[model samples]
Target chain A: MANPSNNYYDLYRHGSLGVALTDALDELIGQERIDPQLAMKVLTQFDRVIAETLQEKVKARLTFKGSLDTYRFCDEVWTFLIRNVTFKLDNGGQMVNADKVKIVSCSSKKNEEK
Target chain B: MSNTTVGPVYDTIIAEVINAVRVDFEENGVDDGALEDLKKEWQHKLSQMKVAQFPWDPKPEPQAPPAPAHAQPTAPPPTAPPTAATYTQSTLSPQSAQQTLSLPGGLLPNANPMGIKPEPGFVQAEPAIKQEPGMQPIHPGYNPANGARPTAAQRAALALESQYGQRAAASINAIHSGMQINPAAQPQQVPRPGQAPQQHMNPQQQYRQGVAASMQQRMQQVPGARPPNGLPAAQLDGLNDATDTASGPGAVHPIMMDRAQIDEHLHAQIAARAKQMEGGGLMLPLKEATKNRSLPEKPRKADGPSQLDGLDDDVKSEEDDEDAINSDLDDPDEGGDDDEDDDETMGHMMLCMYDKVQRVKNKWKCILKDGVLTVNGKEYVFHKATGEYEW
Candidate 1:
């Protein structure tokens, strides 16, 4: 919830992309190749960069249908448990089915206001 | 096909994040090569997830592995194995069989597990069962105050001994230990071996039999009922019946027990019996545990809609979801929270920022944008996604 630098939500650190990046940075810090402070700066830069790339470079769109099993809104974050979800990608209309998916979404406007 | 794009888009983000941080690295007196290593390490970790093709990987091989990785996740249940199905069927049929034997309202919770799933599973079952005494305030008369075992348990012990012979020895012992808490009544003998079939034992006779342990072992597991330190330590609230009753192995103290305390004792008693009947579900696959425990009666996800015929059930279930949302916002999938130990190799989760999340009572609609969505092994990025769901 605390914004370290670049004033971006670090929520995506749970995402595969962010998780992988963190692991890499952890190794660099572990070896003393990069100090912890520099690693944190790298992640802050990542926090800003990934969000920007997803917004500007990616043009794909997706639609999904699922029964909302649970939804909660607190601390400017909305968490949802979507069950029996079927996601359709617009590029070729590829369909993906899952028994359930947990969506952890933060407010998009907060980082931009910075 | 869209996955091919993740490599470039992610590569750009890594390159930019690394390049953007280089000045700080130098300012800290670090070399440029380490900066390059950081980029490569970042890319290496990304490649390890194998979520999508990376621009750095050789072209010929990327297409081969991801296809199979993607294929395996698409079919999750078949991997849960047939053992999960048998566990549910065995538990359900035996309890339903006893239901026909005049065990009224006791197994009502298990009768419609799908109905139960709509509520918080273990937490809801206990409180609902415990509320019965309050509805009829004359209930302490029925309670085993002098430490007699509840007849529901008595019947279960009988059922277990008859069905499994020596195999059910352990569960039968817990039930006997439970009965020792009673000081008032003459301890009754378990039904003699020549006892007639369960069908012949009318409700009145069955109640006199003090049958209980079996129902809770499967009918309704009383969670959080474990005795603190697993001891028959002196009853916390001094009760006259329990004064002499501590000498009895499983005797409950006869005292002025409020409903909550009574619930606690009852849960303790039921949990003891259940511990014997069902071993730890440690062997169950996460997918199986989630599917079976979350929506037990529904059985098959493909037919979830066609099965729940009652509109009332839908309405009640929605209300249950609302309660869960308000009470626990942090855990999106609270039912399967126990399975957190498993590797998150292929979890179905979407991490994105919501532009807006609006709710009109139980009906909810949210507009999520610039999201990274992963369902089934594949990863997807969307400029925007609109979701509408009730509760």
Candidate 2:
């Protein structure tokens, strides 16, 4: 019953775990193993669960600094292409470095609907 | 701090999403086994993405559960191609049957429809050189246009048979001819070709010419009212056409010969157009549009440019934007679906929710939370992230 309007963003479906789940569901549909309507129901549930899990379960923090290459804010999503980025994980002081990184961030206000 | 955290985090998301959708699976009447398969297949695909270390990766149990589901996905693709191939063969069968019907000899029970007609001119068979064999195929092809009309039950039968081959049309015609009124025609027709193939081809031709020449002589004599000697004008016209094609030697009677030519011409044209419609016609308009762009312009101008776009772009585009007669429909794409650009690149991305985002001129800062960051072939999971950058 929780659709896109009242529920969490389906935006994360573009992520790796979501993409993998979608591919799996598509294979099931292609085999006539599951109806396509059921696959959509599963995806809607995935949007709620992944958003809830990430907000509640995760605790570690990281800081990153970069020269932003391109930035666009359209609809409720903010997209940034950053160059020469450096990340410092607060847990153990480990550093991950990259030449370029693209950040896609959604509005946290939408998820705090509870 | 490390890629190790991603393994358990992803495992949690996977288990949670699956548990949530379980009731939906039940309501949809999908088996619990499909739910089980979805989990295994999901993990299998995620592992294939190799985006991070996962709890399922080190153990052999992860590989064990997906083998059955993996094999299932592979099986249907092979079956899919055969279905498409058989579809093409069915659609082409009728046309192929029509083509064979048109050819000259090796006439067996092949022209059963023609043979069933008990064609009187067919009585002078003599291998049916020119006009007769054309009658052979044209008659069978005629069945399709005919087949489209029959009673609903016959239509259903023809439609089903039409899938396998057009040979079904011939068999259906044989059934149709034997049904009620014409039941007597087939019996005498069946064995007559053996004895009748050598009969004289003279009586029909001589009679037709006798009528026409006598009409001509009478036309000169009377000069006021010319009659076909009681023969219909259509019959007289047919015999005149017959005199031209057979040249009085091809063992074809005048009446049957002219009608066959007319049917042959119509069937050939209709068959050629049908073939074109099936083959290149689908994507043809684009090709024709590109090749003959000037063709419609001429007729359109002569008939009246009342058909949209009267004013040329070079002359009148600046008068109004809405009235601009643009030649190409290169309108800008509606909305931004721009994020997919990252999918084509080497993976180094983070997807998150921003708690607070601020901008001062080009300087920007954002507090992002509950994020998945994948960079340098490693995935990092975090509850909160702070990013500062200048654009």
Candidate 3:
């Protein structure tokens, strides 16, 4: 999985917000090109970081976070979570080329981690 | 007492005559044949009257008065008046004696003291008769003897002959003329027994109709109140305030408001936000606070770029406060780029950044934070750092 292969490219793809974030982070940090699976794992990890922070800001009590794409948060506290955060990998980078971030949930304060 | 002397004799004679007539008819069995023979005899006797033969007269007809101009002027033929004795004798002849019949005084003068002229042709038949065509001979399978039963088409024709038919046609014509018919003015027919009357809504429905009409009228009158085309409330605010002032002290304040009022304001704000999310058009009321406040004194527009000069004092102060917070958070010696130490630190930083990013994951996603971080719902120990770098 560490090395890129045609077989890996041909395999099924399930991309998400977390995957994109991890890809951007790895592109910046990892010297050796990382495999798509590892890239997705890292992206999912970053997404959890965002969700957890928003959980604190909005004062949402975390209920659960799962692997196959599930996160739940406390009631009525999700708006603050989405407002003060950004999905960009680099806030200072050019607006057009910056990486995209997507917040999947707010009221449910759960954060997903790989 | 004196009138009784003549009345007894007259009564006896009348009684005998009536009895004799009844008995004779019963014995002879007077039928259609006898009645027709009597009619023919009367018509023949009437033909004998020597009427003046006017050259224009086609036949002898009963004398009648001149007609009014507008009337269809049918000229009457000249004829001799028949004597009472002759009129009586014609109807009472022995050949017709067995027939039981009575002629109206209006048709034969001999039957009454009132001078009634005999109808130009008939001397004994009842004059007050209406002629109805017996079952149409051309229509086969039609029973001529029974007058009551009618075919479907005949029944419909009979129905259309009633007053209701004319009324229905008149109503349809009125509608075609574009004349509004008053609902109350229409005539209603009583339903047949065991049938329900027409279904109609009561006053409540009428009230609803009235309310709907009033609402539509008001909406039509206030053309500018339509949404999307309506003027911004902010533009109208000053006018509203002036009006409110002119209204009196009891008037609601234009600016000051309570929590409920503020809630209304916030509701409008929330609605605007939602609309913005949906890509709908919005109009925000202008802020009077910005209008009244003077431009910051840092520099005039001519002395520097307008963007900088236009910055309000309050915004500059807020930025200064943010800068102070950043400087305090910044760790000393954070500038060192020791490669191996940096790599380990970068890896740790990446890990820490992931934790922070996950913390805010619900609001913002696809993000990384490198400074102080949170991990597994817990705030982790971190050395805060701040630096300016170009990408």
Candidate 4:
């Protein structure tokens, strides 16, 4: 009868949080006009966003105040993000493929001294 | 009945009767023409009866001789006790004859209630009473409540029963607590044939205690332990999902199809892609057969994008790119199929691809601001709480 603050345990039992987060992030990334690489860095910093969100939701009482990568405890945050955020795109919008953005590397031309 | 009616009303009544007859004939399988003739005959008889004036009285039909009526009931004289005289008289009573009626060749219940005027010699056949196969007839009269209620003596017995149960429970508890060490001591005294040597006991006990202590510590840490920390509740689902790959075909997530789309787009960019698979509707079985056919990969020389044919060719190329990539993938032995390889690389290329896509789709700020964002041509209208928009 004890409901854990994050209910990560129940979420794990019922569904895969990682798959869910991957799905949510795919939708979020697809809709953004920003560079895909930067979008990823933002998603990687989800712990910070989660911590801030939880602080707001809980009014700072149940704080997930911990360092990035150190909060082995924030698995619940990942679970919460996945369960609450992952969604299908409107009008059947799809995950943006990195291949869609072809990387065309060009070297700068130097002025020739004649 | 007055016979003054001589108008459309008579026609209406006749029509209604005809309709009713038709419906009854359809429903009940009676001939309408025959019933109509019978109705006419009945009407003719009624008219004659009316002319003759209603008969005041009718005579009752003659009755058959009521076979010797059974003897009347008489109260049995109460005797001092069951004596020989009363027993002999009881056997000769008319009630004893009634009991004999239950035997074979005796009266059976009516077989057909619908049949009228049954023949005298007709014998009723009893319906077969079907007993459920392999099932016993449960005695409906049996009651569990009868056993539940206890007399004084029964209560005393129950008290003894509880006393014994408590004694047994206490004995079990004592053994569990190591109070009764008879089983343990016997091992040392008798040196049982398959028992481990006593020298190993101390180490084994220490190892068991270590295991138990570790398990208890884990149970306590589990609540606070973060995800992937080996906590029972940790969100190690990513690890779990990696283990299962042989799931059904449809089990591949829709996201995987999007991954496939990368291959699609790459193939579309290729100019020399050909339309291998047919596009229009075909019989389902034929289409399925075509899908199954393992046609050898057609080797096409790669030409530059300038080889693109026409305006329609652009659209066709875009659609066929996916098929081209897939066909290219179909034969991995060929050095070609770089398009598909590019698709496989897309996952690593965009790290936060999924996360970014999710955020873009989500109108979080709008929800936070309690407003909406309208996207127009080259402009974003941000409507706030005041119901106004700004670029």
Steric collisions counted per model: 18, 3, 27, 17
Report lDDT (Cα) of residue B126, candidate 3.
Answer: 16
User: Judged by TM-score, which candidate is best?
Assistant: 1
**Local error of candidate 2 at residue B41 (angstroms):** 0.7
The superposed Cα distance between candidate 2 and the true structure at residue A47, in angstroms, equals 0.8
Deviation of model 2 at B123, angstroms? 70
True contacts kept of each: 0.79, 0.85, 0.00, 0.00
DockQ of each: 0.47, 0.56, 0.01, 0.01
Give me the TM-scores of chain B across the candidates: 0.31, 0.29, 0.11, 0.11
lDDT of 1 at B250: 31
Candidate 4: clashing residue pairs, number: 17
lDDT agreement of model 2 with the native = 0.56
- lDDT by residue for model 1 (B141-222), tens: 1212222344455445545644453466467546644643442342322222222233133322222122121112212333
TM-score for each model? 0.46, 0.45, 0.13, 0.12
- Candidate 1, CAPRI quality class derived from DockQ: acceptable
C-alpha lDDT score of every prediction, in listed order: 0.55, 0.56, 0.25, 0.24
Across B1-391, the per-residue lDDT of candidate 3 in tens digits comes to 0111112222232233223333333444434343233223322322222112222234544454466543211111112111111222223332221111222321111122111122223232212110111111111111111111122432232233222433333342333223212222211111111111111212111111112222222223332243322223322321232233223332133223344445543443454455455443223223422221222222232234553233333345434434444554444424332223333322111122222223433332322222222221112211222211111
lDDT of 4 by residue, B200-288 (tens): 23221211111222222222333224322232222122112111211222124444755665454445433222333432213336644
Best by DockQ: 2
By TM-score, the better pick of 1 and 3 is 1
**Candidate 1 residue runs with Cα over 4 Å from true position:** A1-5, B62-346
